[model samples]
Target: MEGVPGSSSEHECDSNSLHSEESKLRLKDAIKHLEQLLLENDLVAPESSGTISHEAMQIGQDLYKSTVEILGSKMFVETEELIMAESDDEEGQFEEIQDDDDSEQYMLPEKDKSMEYIPLDYKIKVVNMAKEHPKWTLKTLHKQGCSRLKSMKHLYRWEEDIKHGGTIIDKYSIINSWTYDRFVEARVNYQQVTTRNLQEWALSAASQFENFPFKASKPWVIKFKKQNRIKQRKITKYVTEKETATLEEILAAADIFRKQTQVLIPNFHKDFIINTDQTGCQYQSTFNRTLSTQRAKAVFVQHKSSNKISHSYTAQYAMTMSGKLLPLVFICLQEATGAFGSKVKKAVDEFVKIYQNVKVTSSKSGKLTTYLYTQFLKEVLSPYVKHEKFLLLIDSWGGQTNPALYDDIFQDDNNVGTCTIKVIPPKCTPLCQPCDVYFYRQVKNLIKRLQNCSFLIEQKREIASREDCIKIHAIVHHQLSAPIFENMLRYAWFASKLTDEREVFMNVNEVCFPLDILKKSCDCKNVTFIRCAHCRANYCFACFYDKYHPSTCTVPSTSTDE
Candidate 1:
């Protein structure tokens, strides 16, 4: 009896091993449910119609399509037969439903929206399982769902997908990744295999550190399983600070003069006013071997130093949120100088070349030509920005943001959604250079640190666009010490704990002002700071300074009033 019990357990284990894949389980579940449904309706059980539908062959076809899609036709043969059988079974049941003259006068699909379009392979799997699982009873069906995903990785990915749409046929599945694809290499642009024996016969090992304390290549660590290992590898070519002339470097250091100008000037809102400025991170990278080093501390130091590029061009938009001048929106961009609309059809085509040829991360630069400056606000940032009075803080260099651009972007009539922008008034920086004060110092530190680390290079060769390079930085950035990375995000955003309590913005007009602001700022106190001479609304002091009034409007009268 004891031996018999053990033998039964073995049989059960064997059964499960044979049908562990998700497709197989789904098929089993479908058939079990069908049988129950038929019993409830008191329908005659087809002696031959095992769990599949013969009446609606189309349903079976659909299942076959799903099966071929989920498991692949080449990989899942048995799944195909089950789907075909279900199609035949559906045919009979469907006919009976159609024969009922008193039935509801509408044709209905087999499944509702809750039950969605499954790929061909998955559909086939369900069909086959049902065909084979006649005697198997479904004790319960527990559909596990999830929400409130907090991982920064997931949040960023969702935002990126929303902005770019997708490659080839546009489907919402890419937008909706309910089924997570955690493939190790899905996001990486390039990879290389290794020859180490310990690495070869890999077993998952307890990491000496929970997070790698440095920024470097992905394969962040060689996460080896008992039989396999995973290591993140990053390959960014470090820009060696080759003996830059201290005087020239001081000249290269754009932040110094901006700071001095800020203190000398009062109302000191921000610094470095340019007629126009470039966007996007300044320092970019390519492949590097610096990461292959086994020491954790060394990698961390190397990464912190060399990545001295800024995240975006500082566009100063004085936003009226609660009557406050908030510096918002870092317009990081790639110059559109090389792209012409008539020659190429899309902004994407112009960007595609840079995607491969240059380091494509949010932070970038390789021999700075024209200083790029456009906020790289993708899906993640857009919605939040759209919600509040979103403003971009930048130097005066970015040609005054066109009023038409503002009208086109911020007005509901334009359907550009809705936003508020106020270009920070020119000649203010000591107290309010969004990132100028905080971010510059941080990048300078990182640049200096990486400069000292010994770089392991295959050889000195420059390549444009290195997506893999950025991937590595992101991975290492995650592993590095918290103080370091938080600073990185801060520098990227050009935000600080401090912003002016009172800034002059051209209050947006809804019928007169945006609804959210209507509630938030008391409609700019019903008494606005500056009024537009051209329009009825309050003059967005910052915006008018940049776009509408730069060339023609009267200069802002200086007043010490808070």
Candidate 2:
């Protein structure tokens, strides 16, 4: 109770100062604890610690130091461990809550499934389903129990691949094996790989591959166009073994022939070069294709009488390298009797009237004989050539290459400088014969077209008579007349190596015999004529009878052996 001098004031001041210091110390401890908790939980960043006031940071550091000193290093370590364990527990709880939310979101039926979870079994099922229901979309597949296959993009990709000849099964190795086997079979057995063959092979191939997931239709096979083959040319013995003159040999021969001709006839023109060939035209009409139902077993047209007769006329045509087509010489296979025969003769007369160079002869078998060949040379070639030195190209036929015929033409006193004959190599007609190479194909095609026209346009079903055949020939002749065949002649000459250039022969005029002179000079009637089944002989009844009527002669002799 006694008031000492300045003692109360000093005591009060000391107490106030102690209380303020205590408050500051408590605040420091709380901040330090807060920082420790934040650090343990990874909620506070060390980098952001500098944003706190310097005074507050200093107080926190001092409290942390004092606490570390009081509790010792072991106690501090224990406290840190406790804080970390609590923080870990809290994090585990939060993660569990988040996982519950995520599970609920994923489990919802409305959520779209990802393709990552699709099993191989499910993918295969979907593919099989798609095959069964080709019109179904991916959503449809999913609705039909393929829940794993969710995306239409994946489904469309697979569908497109299969649609365009792609297969889900790996059967390429098997296909290649079968193809090689079939190829060998074709090579050894002379078999062709037809569409049916391919279909059969495809069925076998599909059988080998279990679960082949595509239709093996014609269109599907066609899609693999590079793999499947069509229209391949068959390798023939003739193509492989046929003897052809080498380019060098051909060129050399041509040069030698040219030099020899130039020596014999100075400045020999292209018109002087001539080629002759014989082709047969059937009297019967034929069609390449006819109108018929696709399902029909067979289609037929009316068979003409010509078809039953099996008669064909061997037409011998001559052309200059310059393109001048001479009149055709038609050898009919008929006797000079009956309506058909008379009609043939009349038609031949008509042809002769129109084209003065035309010559008609008949044989039981429409083929050229030695006598007929000689007649062609004398009647057709000799008058055309006259005294002009000419080159003649002919195929190597027995009658054409006869030494007697050659001698008769070249050694005749009047024909001493008339012509020279060159025989194309044997079996090389397709390569070397100008007529075979260019003219005959076009001629045959035109004849076929004419026959078709006669049947289809004229509606004639009866067999064409000899007269009709002659008329057809005449029509074809007029259509492919001199002017038209002239270009073909040039092309043939160029193609057959007979001429160096078509341009060199463009200016040559057509060579035609004067009708009056030709008619006066012809002595065909005086020549003896006999018909044979295989060929005809134009020999005098008094001479060359034995020679003309060989063992193959089928004709009965009408003349006595006097």
Clashes of each: 108, 3
Model 2: per-residue Cα lDDT over 26-100, one tens digit each: 546756765654553355565665466868667666754554332332222222122111011121111111222
lDDT score for candidate 2 against the true structure: 0.49
Q: List the residue pairs that clash in candidate 2.
A: 304-463, 305-463, 306-463
User: What is the Cα-based lDDT of residue 496 in candidate 2?
Assistant: 55
Give the best candidate by TM-score: 2
Please, what is the whole-model Cα lDDT of each candidate in the order they appear? 0.29, 0.49
Q: Per-residue lDDT tens digits of candidate 1, residues 1-562?
A: 2532122332232233345678567757666655543443345354655554555566665654554343432233331122221111122111111223423343333332122223332222222222223222221000111112211122233232222222111221221121111122122213233322122111111011112122111121232221233443565643335422232232223345334433433432232111112222323332232445566655432233243323222222222212221222222233345323453335434443433212221223221222222232332234334533333444544443454544443434346544333343333221234444223333323322222212222223221122322322222222221221332333222222132222111111211222222232213243222333223234332343223232343433332111
lDDT of 1: 0.29
lDDT of 1 at 480: 26
The segments of candidate 2 whose C-alpha lies over 4 angstroms from its true place after superposition are 1-267, 306-310, 334-351, 354-357, 410-417, 454-458, 461-463, 482-485, 502-562
